[model samples]
Target: MSSAVIDLKNCDNCPIRHRAVCARCEPDELEQLEDIKFYRTYDAGQPIMWAGDQMEFVASVVTGIATLSQTMEDGRTQMVGLLLPSDFIGRPGRVRASYDVTAVSEVTICCFRRKPFETMMVTTPHIGQRLLEMTLDELDAAREWMLILGRKTAREKIASLLAIIARREASLHLGKTGDGFAFDLPLTREAMADYLGLTLETVSRQISALKRDGVIALEGKRRVIVPDFDALIDETGDDADGGLLS
Candidate 1:
């Protein structure tokens, strides 16, 4: 499919620029990024890269969501990472992808060619430091997910996923206040099941149960509103003080 057409000047408004690769870059470094950066888009359900595929560049999400999933030879798939808006994808110094990256929703990405970016990293301390911080944050998130996959109960898994999405959504739209807030669920039921290591039926059933128990209200299969964030966290087996995963 053809990638989405977007202007590079739009980088000024990019959420990830101030948060990811460009966060601590010097003015000249930022200027260098502008010269090499390009934009690409993917439709929902499209595979951005397959495991073991050679990746030529690294990118950050400009919009929409993506996921990194690994499948065993026997076909058991586990989602290892969830990429939201502004989240970076691909790894520096890695040529082959380690997981399947798929667009969970129609997505746009701001891409920087790996060769030039790597060269700049060596010459620019600020850029390298920012990249290191971003990479470490991703590692921390991945480790947290490992715990979710290996130890959390099915219900806890689902709740943890919801809380995560809700928190991210809240962060994305800062300053919005209310007892309830709505956001689109980027993953399909089948995708959620794969991520949570549950059957599709179990994912569907648990969502229904959450709705029935008043933990969340669903406007449709994709739209979700948490009436109470703390209550939802409670369902995740998290401490009332939000210390469970911490």
Candidate 2:
């Protein structure tokens, strides 16, 4: 997921100014965006869009988490993506929803109506280019995920997931890691199982194994603390500097 633009009261002071689609936009271009953009929020468990539904807006997550998932014919739901703060939502050119998007936590999103945004895209080459960059970033993240899923064993997969989220969160905040850090697992065990393609029992068991091995500590059920970040990386069988390798 793409990180969010920092908007401290309005677009003018947005921190993500250099990374968002508007990164290269001029003052006038920003002003035009300020005119068309608005914010919408969803409560946890709320549906942002059902697959096959008509979607009217594309947005950026300002806060919280969203899940992109699809239900199979037998009603098995599988998670395909996790959207974190600053991640883009909606396809710029698509008119129909491609998957069911749900707010896994309370979510606030900065929204742009699709038609207007598309019109702006035509007039602004920078927006087009920044979008390409974001798409490429997504591809890089996906490749990393595929490696985790395809080759890693269940314990390794869970460790890799924890490592990736920790690294990504640090990159979003301080842009680097220190000795260690802590974060809550945003997804429930069931959700994690769906994403990892594991049974819920297996997910819980591997987590317990990691905690038992001293790779991670569980403050409670969801909170995780890594005493040594490199040790956690060691559990993943990756080089010490990774968790974002693609």
Candidate 3:
């Protein structure tokens, strides 16, 4: 991966500033972060970190997508999570990375040196509180993923994945027009197959089926247009309110 630094955007103008780890910071806190922050860019498919590597800094994704994967002794790797824009990249108390992180798209991150960040967290209650909230959010998403992988059909899996990405995009104030939205599918069919425990052909077939049924539309190969967000959610086999229906 290239280690080149990019021109830094001031924290106030950063796209992810409001949702990122520094979201709750006051003016002084932001200034403190600025003192410690730097920007790094990585090309798509480049390794950002390996399992068991020393992590000298913690970061928040400023743009693009990344993935967290773990490799087994047999040399097989399973992607465990996706880091969308504004996602945090490290745990404060952790000295080493537990998963291999890779850029799924060209990515940029705002990083703070670990020692100073940990000290700041001790002095700054907002940072710690926000981190806790984000961790719990991640845990909830993991539970949903377990249900998807264990019980959902192939079609449901694809739809669920799409819905998840679309929801994340919506949170970032992107691609929303009423109840419909659009986003570029970041993962290849092969990658989606691996993550969803389906064959590549099955992944393609299910996407085609979604298009045929008017649940979604496509522009070129990767851009997906959800005509009705609720209609797409119906295909995920999930309750609209995220609870059991009466």
Candidate maximizing TM-score: 1
Using all chains and alpha carbons, the TM-scores for the candidates as numbered come to 0.90, 0.88, 0.87
**Can you write out model 3's per-residue Cα lDDT over 50-74, one digit (the tens) per residue?**
9899999998888888988877899
Model 2, TM vs. native: 0.88
Q: Record all residue pairs in model 2 with backbone atoms less than 3 Å apart, i.e. clashing.
A: 3-86, 4-86, 6-16
lDDT of 1: 0.82
Q: What is the lDDT of every predicted structure here? A: 0.82, 0.80, 0.84
Candidates sorted by TM-score, best first: 1, 2, 3
Clash-forming residue pairs, model 3: none
lDDT of 2 by residue, 99-213 (tens): 9999999887777889999998899889888888888988898787787778889988898889878887787677455555888788899989888778899999999999999
Q: What is the number of residue pairs that collide in model 2?
A: 3
Candidate with more favorable, higher lDDT: 1 or 2: 1
Total backbone collisions for each predicted model = 0, 3, 0
Query: Once model 1 is optimally superposed onto the true structure by TM-score, how far is the C-alpha of residue 118 displaced, in angstroms?
Result: 0.6
Q: Which consecutive 10 residues in model 3 have the weakest lDDT in total?
A: 8-17
Question: Candidate 3 clash total?
Answer: 0
